[model samples]
Target: MKKIFLVAIAVFTLIACDKKEVDADANIHITGDVKGLSQGKLYLQKIQDSALVILDSIIVNGDSKFESHIKLDSPEMLYLFLDRGQTNSIDNSLPFFAEPGNIKIETTLKHFFADAKISGSKNHDLWKKFDSINSKFRDQNLALMEKRLKNELKPNATTTDSIEKAYKSLLTRKYRYTAHFAATNGNKEIAPYLALSEIADINTTYLDTIQKSLTPEVAKSKYGKMLNEHIKERKTLEVQK
Candidate 1:
């Protein structure tokens, strides 16, 4: 009987140990491999209430590789800081949108942010898409300016008016495109993100529609909350006048 009781107690202990040893769910697992960085500290930061808050940090020693895990509540932008002990503050920080997944970051110590290769986040992918569309509008403006400059043609009142109208048309098209993207992509977290990042300067009613059109999950995200608050504030201010 004594031996049987001891065996039962051992089994119970084993089960308890197994439960306690389960691996935690990491929202972000960042594995970084940096050349020439044998020993240094890297910090993961997020902006909160207009302040930069350090979420996590890791020290790389012996090998030039380090790993870090961050608990993310929702998809938002994050910054990686490399503290190289340099007096010159250039080429250090890399900002990337972080989703709940494994993200790989590989860069060298010489030129950190410029050479950094980050992958595996869909939020960042949407950000690139937004940038690509915005770039076309900028390129059109640059081309117009270049044509005027290279021809040595002065923009007289009539010429200036035509140029202004051309630019205005481009702006209007970009704004419409932005609104369409946000409305159609309302299920994705990027929808709310663009509402604030890209089209906030447009009409308040449009912004309100974007805010209201966000899907329940995306609406609960950080950027989504900001969109709701921004629309509310703007409407309140307009009412005050």
Candidate 2:
């Protein structure tokens, strides 16, 4: 009878251990390797009330691989900050969309953000797609500004005015593209995030359209709440004008 009781206790302990692990898995688990990095500090951070907050951190002593875990109420944009213990600070932070799951990031110390390979978050994938196209718009804008500067040296009013008009047109197109992208992806958290981050200064009509199209769940997210508040403030300021 004592042997049988011992066997039952062992089964119970195993069940309890398994249950505990399953519960832990429900939280955000971030694991990654920073190549060419022998020692540094990695911080998992998020923006709260317009301020950056660290959720978790790990010290990398000898191993390049690091892991961090935190609980998130909803899917939001998160940043990974690397402190390389150097005086010259550049390319030290990497941004990735984080949700309640396992996310992996792999990158080298040389090109932190540019060389990052992130996976396990659908929201991050959508952001990547949006950024790819947005980069082209930015490049075109830069080229137009450069041409305008060159024309300024000759002091041609007509050429300067023409370039200014083209630049304004390009800016409007970029804003419109951002609005449409947010409106169409209302079901995801990225929609409100783009609205608040990329096109907050856009026309009130476009902002209202994006806000209304957001899903109920996303509309209550951190970015969605901020977007709503921003629109209200903008309208209030316009009314006073």
Candidate 3:
């Protein structure tokens, strides 16, 4: 009888361990170290109904390392906001693509977003690649703006016209590139996200093409649904106009 009781206790313990492991697997486990941060609050946030909502948060008392977890239904864009008590700066928030499973973020207190090193999320990796190229377009636009300002100081109609034309051409190229990127990456959630965020004001025909190109799985994602709704709203306003 004593032997049988011991065997039953061992089996129960094994079952309990398995259950805990399964639960952990279902959650998004985030761990990171904020170098130079002695005390602060870190928040895991997502956009819901056009508002930033906090999913989880942790307060670091003296240590720079922190961990947070939250259940995710599907991969989407999320932000890690750091609030260093009594220190105000515009570089505190870091945005990352979040999916279920483990993600690690390492950054310093001084340049939170610029110094962030994110790992373990494939969606974030994809966004990083897209953003790298998109940034080039932005840089070109800024240079063109500088040229326009310099020309405006002298007020030459010919030079102004040439710069204006270049600006229009650059804008068209940027829009087309964004559309192509979204359509080519239709299988990823980032596809619809980029469309809605970057080029929603472009031709509705382009938006229509992107919406149709989304895979069945991606079409049901959070950003995918928002893209669909946004397209519909744009069409409705067009008709009213």
Candidate whose TM-score is highest: 2
lDDT of 3 by residue, 1-241 (tens): 9999999999999978744232454578889999998987999899988899998777887999988767878888999999866776889889999887899999999888889999998889989988998999899999989998998888899988898898899889999988998898888888899998799899999999999999999999988999999999999999999
What range of 10 consecutive residues in model 2 has the weakest lDDT sum? 17-26
Among all windows of 10 consecutive residues in model 1, the one with the lowest summed lDDT is: 18-27
Candidate 1 similarity to native, TM-score: 0.73
Q: Write the per-residue lDDT of candidate 1 for residues 134-222, one digit (tens) a residue.
A: 88988998987876674456546766667778878988998889888888778778888888877787889788778778899999999
Better of 1 and 2 by TM-score: 2
Q: Give per-residue lDDT, candidate 2, residue 15.
A: 78
After superposition, candidate 3 runs with Cα above 4 Å error = 1-26
lDDT of 3: 0.88
**lDDT per model vs. reference:** 0.82, 0.89, 0.88
After superposing candidate 1 on the true structure, give the runs of residues whose Cα lies further than 4 Å from its correct spot: 1-26, 87-89, 138-167
Clashes of 2: 0
Clash count of each predicted structure? 0, 0, 0
